[model samples]
Target chain A: MAEPLLSIEELVVDYGRIRALKGISLSVGQGELVAVIGSNGAGKTTMMKTISGLLKPTSGRVMFDGKPLTGVPAHRVVKLGVAQVPEGRRVFAQQTVRDNLVLGAFLRLRSGQKREVAEDTERMFSIFPRLRERQDQLAGTLSGGEQQMLAIARALLSRPKLLLLDEPSMGLAPVIIDEVFALIERLKAARDTTLLLVEQLAFRALEVADRAYVIEQGSIKLAGSAKELLANPSVQQAYLGAAATH
Target chain B: MQTLQLLISGVAQGMIYALVAFGYNITFATSKTLNFSLGNFLMLGGVVGFILYMTHNWPFFAALAAVVLVGMVGGAVLLKVAVEPSLNQRSAYGWILATLAVGIVLRNAAEVFWSTDDFKFRSPLGDSPWRFFGEPQPDGSMSGGLGVYPQEVLIIFVSLAIVAAVELFKRRTVFGKAVVAVSEDKDTASLMGIDQKFVILFSFMLSTAIATVGGVLVAPITLVSATMGTVLGVKAYSASIIGGLESGFGVVVGGLFLGVSESLTARFVSTGYKDVPGFVVLVLLLLFKPSGLFGRAAIRKV
Candidate 1:
């Protein structure tokens, strides 16, 4: 395959001597959707954070669009076409929905792309019509699913080349999770941006992903095409609620 | 008439406190740290203004411009020397002590380099009271109702203008909104490519600059001295706390309440008891609503 959009090489991260991601490696090719599905404490979020420049890895490399991203602060990381929808849908709660959308295009607006930014904001409103209806409403007043939609819209406004989505289904109702996943599938079908998603609902992620990595105890235990993994006995037994003896 | 005059005087004084309190709020919002040396920054402006405008006879506006310049530079230096280092360290209260130390150093430096004794600062608008509804006497004295100082009027107008301008900036401008974003959530804000460190630095600069201008404006009413900012700083800080550190309008109300209360108490009660009633109210108010008037109580996530 032509060089992947994002590549991680033997990435190791620690939380004060408690190793979270131990020598893990992964990659996402251009216009591909790759999912990392695992249970809690599997270092999936840690890996996402490291990729987005929020956490410093003790050892290893994160190469994005042919540049080493280690030690670059999170603020600079986003400017280089990498944006993450952090876990828990962390929107600017105090600001209006419109303001949140405007801020998503922050770097673009700064470099004299006001017209493009404004156009993109309208595009976001079109994609999520609920946002258009409540553009003037404070983001904090939105329901859990709406906040998640706003968060995705906010990140998408950056027009990122690579998007890291950490737990899109976190703390959402089952119906909202389905809606979020449907949006993800729509984005995947469009095929313009590469995505690296970390999710706890293994089956749900595997349902839409082209390929999936199953992580356990801070390491990738399985990696393969989604169809192959869905057929695998172990993946089904461990994550898909199949009856099996531990 | 006496009550009205007292109200005006109190309002002017209170506005100064509100302006300085606003300085405290700006820095605190961006960085979660207060510039304890803010009051001394005000003193620095006053002394500098006095030297240029009175002693050296520079044009009033030029002196004011120079004072503002000094304030900006001082604020930047303060952030670099006092705030950033503490933020880098592990200690939570390091910044508080660091800022307090900077304030002390500024006060001592002023005392040693300049005069320890107080000096009168002549107002650009003249020191004489503007008598309203007055009857001129045979001795050319206008003994009248509601006599007000031009300086006090200037103080009220200028302070309100500064507060309104800053509040508008935060609400209207993109860069200003970036500052607000950083205050709300620095980590999430970074995902939007907002440089929070730069925001913090900008806040410090703006806060100190406001305090310095306040010092220059207030010098005509009070005296210019090293000790000038000590009490004013404490009261401004108190005013900020009383108003709700997060709310812009709250500080104004807090300052006005304190100012009017002090003025009334000074006239009706003993002059020494002027500070007592305000402090007592602050203590009582905080006991019920720790967030201050207009402040929202923080709800922590479990």
Candidate 2:
């Protein structure tokens, strides 16, 4: 395997007195889609937050492409090409959809190069045509699925090398969830984007991810190829339900 | 004719109030906190300008530039000491009171340095009377047509120019868009590499500069004193709240509206009760619109 692009070594995170992540270690190669599968409160989101610099880890280190990401602020993290599409699709509700996306690449924008930003925006619109349909619409008014799409599209505007997606399929219809998954698969294939995805939908996430880690109570319980994890008896019992167990 | 002149002067005074309102709007849009001490910044503008012009003997343009630069610096300090600390502690009220405290200190410091006596600011636009339908009479008094002084014209033009410039910047500039982004979601703006702290600092500085200019321009018409900006800042804030702090155009229009309305009320009604209409509008706006005339209603999400 190529040298790891991201390495989270023995990372531990705490929320006040509560230990959210306990000595968890994982790595992603330069061009790989890795998935962390867990139920709610399994520390999947906490891990992603810590990596994104929204939350600080109590111990261990997050190294991205050989750079130590210790105690860096979230905004500065983005400049290093790590863009996180946070859970719940927190779009800027008051702003228009286009403004929302434009803000994604705000740090790099120059006063004289508005046309360039517009072009990048148009590129995002082409990938997610639904967003193009409502460019001027307020982001808050978008439906849950559209908001999810908007969240991802906005992240893409940052031209991220590493895309961290947290629960992209949460609270979406079956069709919309499929659409989101399809887009993720496309992004991984076309852009050569490194993805660290946290998801409750194990089967769906594994379909796109090359490797999978099953986290339980803030520790990695199992790690294997997508095929191996899917065939694991405990994962089938706990997450995939009785139908998969059979 | 005397009454007409005072009414014109009152409108000019109102315009100054509106300009200060714009400053309050800038800070309020970003942090949802209005600096109650905004007036002190305005007072500092006049005091600083007077010192530069009269004491330091700087040219009028140089004095104006120096005062504005001082206002910007003062704004940055206000954010650092007042805003940043309070935001870190999740205690927003500290910013309000801290800023107010800073204002009091500045005003008192000015009093001690400049003394408590009132003084008139020399108008850079000169003592020439302009034909606002008529010229001034021989007796240092405006006569002929609907006589107006050139300084009043300068005041009108400058206020309008600032408003126009602000509107253009907000709409067209990249920094302006970044500010809008910051206002919408600071986290995202930061994530995009738009330095959240820098944007906050810029907004405060820009806001104070405008308010300071309002003070500088109107000081000639009103007495330059420590108390010059206290009531004016409050009234201007009322205008911002009434005009929707989010929209740059709304601030200017709200200011003009307040200024013109106050003049008309004082003319047709009681001069002593001129301020009553502005406060009444503020109360009514809070009770009814709450969002202000130009403000968009924000919908809360869980």
The best candidate by TM-score is: 1
- For model 2, how does the per-residue alpha-carbon lDDT over B1-302 read when each residue is reduced to its tens digit? 65676666666766787788878878877776787778888898988887888668899999999888988988998888887898788774777778788888888988887768788787887665555555657876655666666677778888878878876776566677778777877776666667777888888998888878877888887768988988888778877878877776677667777787777777788778887887888889899988788888664342
Q: Docking category for candidate 1?
A: medium
Candidate 2 chain A has its poorest 10 consecutive residues by lDDT at A237-246
Could you tell me which 10 consecutive residues in candidate 2 chain B have the lowest summed lDDT? B127-136
- For candidate 1 chain B, the 10 contiguous residues with the lowest summed lDDT are B293-302
Give the TM-score (vs. native) of candidate 1. Answer: 0.97
In terms of DockQ, the best-performing candidate is 1
Taking the tens digit of each residue's C-alpha lDDT, what string does model 1 give over B1-302? 89999999999999989988999999989898988899999999999999899899999999999999999999999999988998899789999999999999999999999889899999888899988878888997888867999999999999999999998988788887888889899999999999988898899999999999999999999989999999999998889889999888998888988898999999999899999888997998789887898798543221
Per-candidate interface DockQ score: 0.59, 0.54
Off by over 4 Å in 1: A242-246, B136-142, B298-302
lDDT of each: 0.90, 0.82
